[model samples]
Target: MLTNFRRPRTERMRGGGAYVEQRTNSWAALVGFLLGRGYSAPAIAEALADGTSDATVRKMAQRWGLPAWGRKADGFIVIPMKLRDRATIASRAAQEGLGQEEYCRQFLVAGARERGTFRSVVKEGLDL
Candidate 1:
């Protein structure tokens, strides 16, 4: 038996922009490629040739369980920490035989996992 599948409709954003195609495996792959290469959501949307907003790209990445998108240097947020906190992080990192930065990353990842879904954090502009 043969069946026909209807193609997904592509629509432009309200203000007129790139065509937003239905999310599919190929689209997911494209997202992964862009994210893996450290491309920002805006850049990804631009590359998609769709005039969609960066929010769309962010949503898609979360839906696809894509890794942290965008360049590490560009994505990380720097905050001043108390000396006690810094010492604690350094000590813990030393115990794990990892760099302070790597240890802090793992620590944050664990905390984020416990807090809630990643979409909220991503939407809040907290890129990892």
Candidate 2:
């Protein structure tokens, strides 16, 4: 004759008690960090020096909704301005029948030309 026997089950620990998260070497993470620190895509790429291109960094920044710093390579500038200033610009742009970007570009170029600094600035790269 044989009797059936049952064994008690043991429970394992759940949740991350004493668990340390490891740092990742992902490019996206690096891009986000650099962008958060106000570093331009070109600057970030140069800092990385890992064969990553500026375009790639820009794309990553856009995908992650990061505040990308303005650079010539980006073909545009992102100026941080007050809401009231932006509204004024928007109104002026509408009156001129030009998009916000074109209005800003034209305004900057006109100012630079008037100041006689445009030529020199273009010849010798902008100081950022």
Candidate 3:
């Protein structure tokens, strides 16, 4: 089969000053890049998704601090202690029969999907 690997679309915001994107190799990275550039995580994600939906962005913001973006120097919110507990990691590992590294990779996909960075996860945990 043959096809054109078109670059993801880049559209100017409604009024004009800002722009959104569609091509991202790593969704988490997309969020990080947006933060590094000073865009609110949701705004960046919403732009990337062409303003079609805000669910993903909202979810990411809620879970990973996309909505609560600010000049934290760390670029984004650090994982809250409640959500960063090792027990959760252990449970997740046991659930997927995956090690820590694999479990972490799954977050990359989750982060992407959370912010509408991509449609599917390229590196699934446990290969399942």
Best by TM-score: 2
Error of 2 at 11 (Å): 32
The order of the candidates by TM-score, greatest first, is 2, 1, 3
Per-residue CA lDDT of model 1 for 14-77, tens digit only, reads: 4355555455566566667657666688766766664668898888778878776355455653
In model 3, how large is the Cα lDDT of residue 41? 44
Q: On a 0 to 100 scale, what is the lDDT of residue 17 in model 2?
A: 59
Q: Clashes in model 3: which pairs?
A: 21-48, 61-66
lDDT of 3: 0.53
Question: How far off is residue 93 in model 2, in Å?
Answer: 0.3
The TM-score values for the models, in the order shown, are 0.36, 0.45, 0.26
Candidate 2 residue lDDT tens string, 1-128: 10121212222333655543332345456667667766666776777665678898788778878664565454544567889889999999999999988999988977776767667556766543
Q: Give the TM-score of candidate 1.
A: 0.36
- Pairs clashing within candidate 2: none
| Count of clashes, each model | 3, 0, 2
Count residue pairs with overlapping backbones in model 1: 3
Better of 1 and 2 by lDDT: 1
* lDDT of the structure predicted as candidate 1: 0.66
